[model samples]
Target chain A: MAFEVKDVLIVLPAFNEQASIVHTLNDIDKNVPGANKLVVDDGSTDKTADYARQAGAQVAQLPFNIGVGGAMRFGFRHASRNGYKVVIQLDADGQHDPAYIPELLRNLDQSDLVIGARFAGEGDYEVHGPRKWAMGLLSTVISRSANSKLTDTTSGFRASGPRAIELFAKDYPAEYLGDTVESLVIALKSGLTVSQVPVAMRKRIGGQPSQNAWQSAVFLFRAATALIIAYMRPTDPANEPHGEKS
Target chain B: MTYFIGPILSIALIAIIVTQLMRKRLRERHALWWAIGAITTLFLSIFPGILLNLSSWLGFVAPLNLVLILGLALMLLVNLQHSAELTDLENKVRTLAEEIAELKLEDSIGKVNVSDFPESN
Candidate 1:
């Protein structure tokens, strides 16, 4: 079926997800037919690029592991440069469902960013203890920055309009936890309209999940620091098409 | 006269800096600044009268005290300068890396056809 959004690219950013790369690509192909799919293999030590290529998705092999921020930036650059009108990012570990791509694209008409939030009162997103507290704190901070309530600030499943594509293609955050926190901060601060929709997410069917509890705390601290910098530092006024909302 | 202490400390420090420079561990650009620092300290230590006159002009208590204070301040300035340069270089390197990574991705994924690029239209 031909999509209403003609120039839409499904971007799957993967790193060492050899076990589920093919499966992820298959889901995109089955769900979103006639869509240009690009798998950004972020310097995976395994044969992720080869598997993704065999699975019939265009493969962009990074020279080294540049983290999710770098990989996503690469995908965005490819989409922006290629004249793709919209880009929907999906995680490679089968955790992100491809069914919500249409909803995200449709919402892109009004907002520059449409996030597929798992905890948007639609599904069960379980967390406990300090991690839950951290998520709540992050959600509050991101909501204020975005000028809209965002339940899942860390959700990788999101879509971007031309303005966001242009911004990210030029410069995106490349830090430990900068992908989600710093990128959102830039989008909101640059006066881009940001919104979220409820979407159910799946548990990782395969592949190793990076980050331990200790590492997660460190990442939280780093992401929080990046958020502060994004707020404090003055961005180029000309780059921001929509004037500062705050 | 604070003679033995000054020469001994500065000489040891200068010796290490020079050795590092010779070994290519320190770049010529940074070596020049360290060399200047070493010479300034050595000159001030050897000539107490010069420091005495300089301190009197600056309204410091004594040349012996001024030498330490001035040297410390100069070193701090040098460190600050190095830090600024390092930060500039780091930013440049990071930008270059991201660009290279983007270009490499384009190459491996699909070489962008300039004619197909939307900007041309």
Candidate 2:
């Protein structure tokens, strides 16, 4: 039962990323040849969908912007329906290198979810101020919840197997900070095994970084709130370990 | 003269409610509660002795305090219901948006409106 590259779906959630959409698609093709590529256009005003279609990736255009959480939920449902065994979420800004797709998928053999973590000694990526503090605290708290040490809980680059895919497609949170921060909590709480691999992050090929200094400061508060809510959520039957449906 | 103000205000509220209902600006389900409240207030205002007796029975030292409390409680209930409805709508909208994207992807084959199918490499 060997897994083929074609069985993996690489999902890129792009928001007004017309500048780098084509380049990112080509990079994925070059790195993971024959792998299926899907670009969920989050109501980009620019020509992101057009460019992605031109570059040979399936484009799912959302009618309006619903953030990355909404776009990724659509992606998971697409993968689940289309029979993709593995899903790797990569950023459209080209910050995530496609070279690590194989490494992530390889880890999926043993674990249900694999995260391409930035702070795990692979790259010299650094954060400062409130953002750094928030990341550190989140890693500590979530690592305890998952019963394993996770150095990067907020990394967007991750791979999900069939179990994680089924759960996420059914109940992925669509709130602010829900995609990255809350998704990890949901996966771990649902009795899925989670692991991380170190990967170097690159500068965006185009478009501005979404966060500012003020946002980073506010991120500390928002991230904490999101975590509290995730923890306090009534345990859903779907979130329980498989076959324990109540 | 001042004692008549309460009855006049209650009558104005009832008139406004009826006008809104006739114009279809408010759903009957929502206006039902407001209409009942207005009519009750009108009855109590026209017969102050009834309000006085009820407030005394309810152990209120002043009838005005009872009026204020009832008004506050009604507003709180309305606000709470609105918040719940808003959350429900948000969830529905998210699901619809996702379904729309899914259907568009399905309808994309042989359609020129969406992105062209990438040529087989």
Candidate 3:
């Protein structure tokens, strides 16, 4: 069956991404035809919100910079409220390829959550060495604990259907770790299907990536603890049978 | 001199408890760093000569005050980050609440619209 573009919404959680937001928006518009774009500008000091809006995408300008997790929560809530059947999360840094969106969305038909896994295919991706090691170790631990097959648990590019959106909208870990591992764990515990599709990642367009050496170490420590807690805690209320009224 | 040790130990115990209580309310990320900072300060306080020697290595003219200020500043930054996080969480909660209200309204409207239809035979 052909996918309906109107049912899909692209969410960009941007923070100080003025230099790249326009390009990212244009790329998504050109590639993902008819898919509505929503850019949640996380209190950018530049013209990120203006440029995104002018580029023919919806804009949600936050009052302050709430980090990536906070921005994503806002995007998820917006997507849920606006009746979007599937919401694809794309980074504002222009590192993600819009052409691969169709592939990610395709997997959504079979899975509740579809992630763009950069490590799945037989290709050389330019991920930083330290980050790769950390992500590998983290994903391994998370997959083993959650009883799920996860290759790239730290990738930001993900597509979520309504079920996934409802689960995320209620309780998402809002921090620097992004919605990678946390979302997968939630989906699995909720009995929702989760899968990954191979997609190549590129170097960021402008500005430095958020994870520096110090920050990455900090994130690893924090995310590991959060993951353990998430694994122990109950899934969101919506995930439970009695809580599925929505 | 012996009596001084008792009061110092009491003060140290009180400080540790107070810091731990504060840590409980902090976000996990900030709390970890804060705990580290508090423990380090407590350690240096118990062994004041460590700061004095480290300061000499760093070429600080007066190591005691410098070390104390630096530790305080680090803790302050962590506190600031925590405050910012709380504000962000508050805003997010407000936004989620508004969205929930809207969703409930739409759901009720849909229910009412369905009820308005005529009864089937």
Candidate 4:
């Protein structure tokens, strides 16, 4: 089977992001022309799906409000079923710079997974207080478990090759299971090459941030605990056998 | 009247046993705490005088029944939270499984030969 390199799909997960979905779509169309864009509207009560569809992107409306993890899983399934050679996860709140889409896509040729590291670049952007603390705790745990340096364990901007899309589409933690960080760990443990690319992040365009101080604290505790459990759990054969295949 | 104590104790023991059995299906960490609360309630109910001194010290405002009820309420809240957590986890697993199936199909397709299809003559 011949695979075309042009079969890359950019997936955006949005929840009640009607305000910024249009701008996010425009940025992707402008920055990554000809690349297919998919928006997973996670049961947004607002007009998120309508605006996303009007913005010239395919939209997948979940039946209920699944978190970021669920939305991403939906997008991954769409990308996989449609035969996308590469899948790029872009945030719908416009914090991720779509301009770096090319750079992320370019890096995927060398690595199975390429993560856009927000903390890797020079520019300064405000990190939400709760997210900052959560990231700090997660980074420490990931560094210890994977024995790999990860500066931005929680950044939503990421690019995955066919291999990664397959792995994540299968076992991606969908509910408060530390999706991004856990995916990274799974990819590394499976011997899939992982790399980080520096990308500039912008402030959110609209809508209140998903979590407040109390919610963020709770999320942080849950996410950190999930990561710890994942680290200690026995590795499944499906994940380990891939290493032998490679 | 003295024999009443024996039947009350037996009923409390049965309640405790039933709750312990039900705890196996409950995911909340507070179930164990609630069990403790129940046992405490039973003990205090059997010997009402044990709480008499404490109740008097608090001006009888902090009645023993109020304390037991509060503990039971807390346990109920925790159990509710646990149920919510379990539901969330189950939903996550269902979605994950669906996504995984889709990806596996894509992976298998990559290894197949599409050229086998005949071109128009």
The top-ranked prediction according to DockQ is: 2
**By DockQ: ranked, best first:** 2, 1, 4, 3
* Candidate 4 Cα deviation (angstroms), residue A86: 0.8
Residue-level lDDT tens digits of model 3 in A59-149:
7766666567766776777678778888899999998999989988888888888888888883467456556667777778766754656
Evaluated with lDDT, which candidate comes out highest? 2
What is the lDDT of every predicted structure here?
Answer: 0.79, 0.89, 0.75, 0.74
Which clashing pairs does model 4 show? A170-B100
| lDDT by residue for model 1 (B1-121), tens | 5567877778988999989988999987878777888888787777768877988999987667776776688789889988999867855655565566666656555675444668867
**TM-score for candidate 4, residues paired by index:** 0.67
Between candidates 1 and 2, the TM-score winner: 2
lDDT of 2 by residue, A103-169 (tens): 9988898889999999999889988889998999899999887777788888899999998898899
Per-residue lDDT of B17-53 in model 4, one digit per residue for the tens?
6766676754345456666666776677677676777
Candidate 1, residues A1-246, lDDT tens digits: the string is 122556888888888888998998898878877788888877789988889889988887766776788778877888887898788899999998888888888888889999999888866767665556667778899898777889888889999888888888876766655778778888887778899989987889786565567766765676567667877877767567556424
Backbone clashes in model 1, listed as residue pairs: none
Better candidate by lDDT, 2 or 3: 2
- Error at B9, model 3, angstroms: 21
Task: Give candidate 4 misplaced runs (Cα > 4 Å).
Answer: A1-5, A126-134, A140-148, A209-223, A241-246, B1-89, B92-121
Interface CA RMSD of each prediction in angstroms: 2.6, 0.5, 6.5, 5.8
